[model samples]
Target chain A: MISKINLAFSQCKKENRPALLTYTVAGDNTKKKSLEILNAIAPYVDILEIGIPHNTPVADGGQIQTSAYRAIKNGIKVKDIFKIVKQFKKNNLNKPVILMGYYNTIFQLGERSFLKHCKRSDVDGLIVVDLPWPENKNFANKCKKQSINFIQLLSPTTSDIRMKNIIKDSHDMVYYISMLSTTGGRLKVSAKEILKNYNKIKKINPKQNVVIGFGITEKTISSLTKADGLVVGSALCKTISGALSRGTNPVRTAENMVKKLRSKII
Target chain B: MLKLKKGVLLIDQHDKNYMYGGKFGGNFIPETLKKPIEDLTNLFGRLRYDKNFIKERDYYFKNYVGAPTPFIKLENLTKHLGGAQVYAKVVSKANGGAHKIYNAVVHALICKRAGKKYIVGDTGAGYAGKMLSMAAKKFGLKCKIFMGAKDIKRQKPNCDAMRKNGAEIVPVYSGSQTLVDAVSECMRYWVSNCDTTHMAVGSTVGPNIFIKICAWSTAQISRELIVQLKEEFGGVPKKLKLINCVGGGSSAAGFWNEFIDYNKSQVELIGVEAGGPKNSKLHAAPLTFGSKIGILHGAAQYVIQDKDGQIGETSSISAGLDYPGISPLHCFLKDTKRARYTSASDEEALQAYKLVSKLEDLSPSLEPSHAFAEAIKIAPKLSKDTIICVNSCGDAKKDRAIITKRLGFFR
Candidate 1:
């Protein structure tokens, strides 16, 4: 199993480089529009965490939910998302793509089918919010066979024993949820607290790369430096929603947000 | 030529009610959970015919809620209004006062057997939660039910039932503050806490196990009708027509099992969804009108969802018929055109409910009123000798005041 923090360290060959991960729900607003947003974001980010829309996204806050709902309404499915990843690969967008969502969609699609899709779609990893360690052992084996990374999340509520188990079971970078509540709830939790948690996890699994997510806005990206990567979801989704509502160019708007996040993370 | 063991479980091919749906009915849950859901589903199937499960279920039905509910044959109003002879299937006979317990008992048992101590569910009517709680208590399990804060007042009787069963009701004040929000909240809770707790889904939208369990429970109506018709008439009717109301499409699936294979026995299955035209557009008439195949709860099926994949409105008079999606089996049934689908307005269902109560002294839950109203339309078209079966899914002793008040017989 790959430690998330170590994975981040291995990927960071460039000097003074901070990995800026851009998050977007596949086929948000419209498939074409979402594609445009992805293309616009391609130049700025290191990895793309594409959100697969499920009816119930428990871990997500309002903004990601809205984006996911839009994507689902636009007739997006797992196959469609895989197509997006394939297109990304065809374009030589070698930046690793991670598909993130609830496990129901994954389970419904079947574990073997999902891992196959990840492989065929050029998806590098998975971050199923509900698939905690030990429970994911069976799926992790399938992912291993498919050469797809099975990512796990370590929450603040997770005990040291559970953390060690999660770290051991994970095959990709550890996605440390920066907050206790759903995504986009609020930004009350500071970067120091996130970093403190990240450092403790890193000590146990020194080989893993740590990425902080949930409520990591553009303004707060700079404060989250202790981690190898910063994942911004709700803010990106909010920008996409605002752009669509205002009839503004979503690509430019997304690009602008990505630029701002990059500056902050750097 | 076929080697069949004496006790070997074999799906009845000759039974017109069999729903293979071409390999879709098989269980797809984890191998560990496969046996429980399968056993529960099989028990549900056998319960309709098995003397014991039925005896236990009927004991609760007759003594706790009251049973052998009268089938109220519609009066002159249906004829005067150019409608069919509607008959109400009084389901208010089930304890906890709704049609939810028909399958909730099996879910509770499966959970308890799996060493699950706590049971959590989302509810608007609180019927599922209450019935689940009652079942959990009987099986010695702890239960917690999630309800939308706004619905706690409207569905007070259901809440009382839950509390009576020693269940803790968690009020959710999330988005929409209704069944959808409650579902979302409950799903979140389950994902975070599926270790010792088995999330008892309210309807047939989760896994194939749920569909099988519900289908088994509902298949009882058909089995009972087989015996009842043989005794009532000289023989069973050649053509079987079954109707029931659908919310998350559980009860309808249960009753519709007898009519699944249209090619063989020529059984007609009709499911009536709630048509709340006077209400908001968020009503649960997805199969009959608005819907697309999307994942909800845990399965891929038709759902009324907004742009953000959040749950939407499902309008119906019966509290039991107020959910956004139908089961996947219903989807396949619709796709294959094996079953006919329709909807009854709230006014039509209410009128049917009143007619049943006044004429036969039988009170039915609002859910079955949809089927009752549809039966009114369908009965006239059939031969006078034709026998039509409507699942009296629930009885409405609690809704006596509402039914009477709606009829303008009381102040």
Candidate 2:
């Protein structure tokens, strides 16, 4: 059976447009506000990637890091993240929810137990930022045991040989880092250059659903529509932070921002 | 050189294969970092076995680093302690005034060989930054040193030396504003410039390749010590105690590398960690306190974290040893019962610093003072025939401000 995540991507592929993936820190501001925000933006979002806020996120840029900090300060726990995903799934079953985070959190919670929580909470997929391929083989197999998609990652720095190995080992989806940067960095390379790299990765395993992430904003989203999917994390997070500071409701602000991002790709 | 048990865990193993113990280390890194790290792993694997590399490295060790630093029996310290005969490897006399220079010089050599023109490093107490700056200048490579903003305020002397060596200082103002933040920021910066810059990781932490590189680099300390040991005892001593302070565990890893294979009856290793200030719950003693296994940077090892797995901020009187995580190799040793680890409080470390200064006329940084304190405690238990050698890995001048603030005017 095709996973819900694969079905979402297939639907987008059939529609001749890139799937719109949005990332937000779970329990940002407050649990109620975070759930409301997820529901508010669920219409435009194809797959929801919720960050399990980490205090020391080496890969996150400043914008997403701020979102995570707020969530952590508001007393977000691993169980709280599952609650948010569960609440969102209760209302919207078709949209896939993927937890993107560092590996320490899951290791702290027993890996098997955490997957049990994922299954119970209806979490469709997982993207452990630090658990790359080969090292992830055991965990990925464990993830597969529960019928969850364990997202693999590729980068511009990844060699052709290693890319093929990674693609072969990957589940249904692969997260292609469009450039050599953390979450919120500006476009150091052109959008055209990003797609060229994206196309090269696509050629390796054309059947695999590859998504482009990092440096993806409204302006760059349309240019990257050639890919299967695009991930907008920092941009939406920046909106949440920017809105809260300006005394605006973050849920409404994020809904509008994600909707605008969705308008571009479709 | 003492032959190591190659391929037992990561000892003598430098191929793309990584780890200290079988389960303690692996390259769990982003895809962007994978290629550069693998390239580094391959480069080190080939270069470590090449005799030419060793010759060129030692050429600098002799001329540039002023190595073969004095290993002397501390008669005054021995008399003051009144039990075991105490000895010390005087690393403060080495260039850049610390054992950190050993890894710094080797990393500079690596950066040059990789065809990279620039090198970047993260520093806590400024010793790593200063040492790498000095080596980068000698190798004619551009250098950038990431330091915590708070460290810049306290460790002025070493920071000044880093600047004088023509390296750019990137002040990190992130969480905890210390070594941990500096390292994270340094890694973030490397993600952008990895094509041209080789990150000279300051300690035996981070990814598996870095742990291996740092272990290989700092192994020079033991390389020289073994020859000195033969000269001191006319052969290697069986009843010897090897002690050093373990922050990120580079110096201790080097000091104990050749001795790991030795039976506990022959060479017993003790590692000292920062116990923080008295009456304060904070500390840098992950291995001493039984921290759980978690991934920090790239390697899965023992780390101090909250109930939610967030890396906790650690406090130490000495900036050098102020870290919440320990080397994977140290964690392995601790679990295997091959080595013992203990903590020295800030008060005890300060007292040890003053005692060593007064008795031996040698001042040590608070980082090594922790080791000295541990040695002082264990010496009374051991007999006079036993030998206890401490790796006095750094100087005290950079710690003058903290020393003066805590202890008042010293006679």
Quick one: best lDDT, which candidate?
2
Task: Give per-residue CA lDDT, model 1, range A1-266, as digits (tens).
Answer: 54332454466635466577878998898777777788878778788888888656666667887888778778886778888878876764466788888765675566777777787777888877655456467887888787787887777667677788878877757788775556775766777887898999989977677788877886787877657777888999999899999999888999998988777756
- Model 1 residue B305 distance off true place after TM-score fit, in angstroms: 4.4
Docking class of 2: medium
Cα lDDT tens digits, model 1, B213-242, are 655554555555555556655564566567
Q: Backbone collision count in every prediction? A: 29, 0
Model 2: per-residue lDDT, tens digit, A121-201? 999999998887787889999999999989988888988888889888888899989888988889788888988888888
